[model samples]
Target chain A: MYTMKWIQQDLQQYVQAKAYVDTIIVPLIPFHFSDDASLEKDAFQREVLSVFMRELEKEFSGRILLSPDYHYLKSADKAEEVKRVRSWVEDSWAQPFHHIFFMTVDSSWKKFEQDMNGTLIWLPQIVTESMQFSERQSVVHSQVQQVGEFIRSYWEDDK
Target chain B: MSEDKRPVSRRQFLNYTLTGVGGFMAAGLMVSPLRMAIDPVLQKEAADGDLTNVQLAEGDITNEPQRIDWEIDQVDGWYESKVSKTAWVYKDDNGDIVALSPICKHLGCVVSWEGSEDYPDQFYCPCHDGRYYKDGMNVPGTPPTAGLDIYEHKIKNGMLFLGKAQPREEA
Candidate 1:
């Protein structure tokens, strides 16, 4: 539990450092919803995510950019959903984010690489029983460092 | 001597003994009700107690009440388990911090604030259509026997905190 807290704090600092370049893009998975649940029929998850984003917008204001939550659709339909989400971001969001953080059990690196235009940050499934109790501080620290490095390298080359 | 020991003396003796025993039993039975009546009178003197302060702060109106959910371990002889609980904190109009329990007094239903359009600015219990004013008073025609339980509070810095509530004094 203590290690988890330390890791969370470190992640917050890392995200804050990256905040200078772009708003943090966090893709929340609707894991609580069953696979059979119809996305269009059930708006609970969308409403909750909307409320969370609004609250975050209030807290961070102009200092950060938060893209609307993506990945509510299935893996087969993910490509289309990603495109739709990207368009929504371009139209609705004030600015584009530099880093895209994806939390998933499966490391679909190639799929995300092809879909997203920004730097891809893969987060290991942290909610599982094994990861929940394991010494995950170093593992999380390394992942954040890798993502941060990618962002720095990508944006610096762009400039 | 056997012939002289007749029915009259035996009946007289039996009557006196039965009366004595019945009187004793009657006095013993009356003790419980007597104690029940007198106990509250004696208890009233000690009931003038001090209110517990929950240590809230000034100017801390967050629009939404801060929810603190916790679990307490309980033991009953051999059995043990955790009991889940929650409390909501808000500031009253007088600037005094107040905490109201979510449990309704009527039938122990959970009452939520601003739940319906009819009572826009009050707590509403969906279970029985009961309503309470924001300050915790029960609506006169409502099913609740008493008002919402107002938890004890005190001011510290700028954050509102809470303590357990006592039953409201009867009107």
Candidate 2:
């Protein structure tokens, strides 16, 4: 369902399912190329965020529109980005999406989280190199479980 | 040719040649089945569907439908991905275990158990307010024109092995 494009045919059905589920998730990511050293870590965190979003989407599909990854420079200003994010959420084509979540690994979003219209969920970067499969699964599962809980809470509040 | 320097009898030559041809044909016929029996060790299965183990004990299942999630390796064309499959599993009144697919037949929205307050003890799709009875039969006049699908399932060592969900005719 997280294919790169939501084509015309998908758009028609999205219109119909709009009444049932009114939420879209935008995974906010920071892309950095300031240096060879820090960019690697940023890339790693982005990959972890990708895994997290896919896991969450699989658990609650169709109900959760996994929007395209929102990428910005690591050094970009957060206060300015908040308005862009608000406009993106507002541009839902009048389809009545209630909740907009901004999923990120960058803790910078934490400082300005209140200013943004979307829910900013800043996750800790998962150390991917040394972990075994079972450990990784446990880590990812525990984190996604929390995300699911948050979604449920938001659903209740929305009602 | 090695030993029959003496003029061969017509019967002797005919008998020897026929025996050799018959032996060759007999050996040719046995080769295919022998190779088939050993082929499993030589090649991998490409078309076999995956069966995921939904780690639910046989005793845990009851008349009340329980939703269980499990992951399986899925092959779609050239891409291999881990797909999460969910089923509403429970034992029916007859004591037979049933696993039903939770997808609403109308437009593939995920249906929830008793999602609507008014539709007591029924599967409800928030989309179009589709409803299904406890038995996975779609209620008429709902947007869904067909019943929820049933997954092919088997119990192995007390664990549930689930296969593809096959759609049944509308109630």
Candidate 3:
């Protein structure tokens, strides 16, 4: 089992070195906004992501891997948007880093599943309504532990 | 002939004192404007000869990007201003350390690393699609005309220190 204590320490270190990680992560966020809407949210997202990336680089150097954040798509949108996202990831993200992790949040999941091409990690929705705060914490702890374990196992197997 | 041979009369003494006071007043009146005019000239001369030495010890090089901020006194015509700038320091592929300026030369926009999906592992300028390779060369056919400026670097002890980025001299 992945220990929460270890994950927390690693995450703390990651946050401390946000600038380096953000150097790689900032340009990936979807930035389209309506003329009527304020760009504050998008700006904040960029700033936060920049900081996060910098910290990641500082903590993990080039060893830390990153995947694009899931882009939630609705049925109403055209296929072009989906294709653009995939192309962006491939041309921009994958070219730099060979491996990426993604979570699917689309309604059909078929398009995303196909586009992800086996690179997707299906994130199960945690039922927060039924769970207490402590339970939610435990769930998060377990999830991170699993992630760490998977990374370790993958590294070991590669060797 | 043996005793007092003081030659100044009272009128001559008064005239001398008044002339001295008048000269002092005149000089005081002219001082501010003269200082205002001469100050910039002196400052420019000082700025032209100004050179700051930065010390780098051997230990400062790590896997992380180091932020280094510095100021240089620059003279623009008659005005002397301290130009403040920063650089990100990191180790390149050859294991030799380098410092790259955060500022983009194209339209003075700031370039951040990994800014766009189209160009990964390179510094990006979001304003005009400007791109810089990892070694800080501006991508050809991009907005930037010149490569990213390289700071003067030296190693002392166990640390890395950087100086100002001057234009590349032809060897």
Q: Best by lDDT, which number?
A: 2
Top-down lDDT ranking: 2, 3, 1
Q: After superposition, how far is residue A46 of candidate 3 from its true place, in Å?
A: 28
lDDT of 1: 0.53
Question: Candidate 1 vs candidate 3: which has greater lDDT?
Answer: 3
- How are the candidates ranked when ordered by TM-score, highest leading? 2, 1, 3
- Write down the lDDT of every candidate, Cα atoms only: 0.53, 0.78, 0.54
Per-residue lDDT of B39-145 in model 1, one digit per residue for the tens? 98877644423232234344545555554444445577999986444456666666555677767675454566775577887887653556888777888898777
For each candidate in turn, the TM-score is: 0.34, 0.69, 0.33
Per-residue alpha-carbon lDDT of candidate 3 for residues A34-95, written as tens digits (9 for 90 to 100): 53253564444444444333333222232343444544323235356556656655654534
lDDT at A9, model 2: 66
Docking class of 3: incorrect
Evaluated at residue B53, the lDDT of candidate 2 is 77
Off by over 4 Å in 3: A1-159, B1-58, B63-65, B73-80, B169-171
User: lDDT by residue for model 3 over B34-74, one digit each (tens)?
Assistant: 99989999986664445343443446655555556556677
- In model 3, state the lDDT of residue A71: 46
Q: What are the RMSDs of all candidates, in order? A: 17.3, 5.9, 15.8
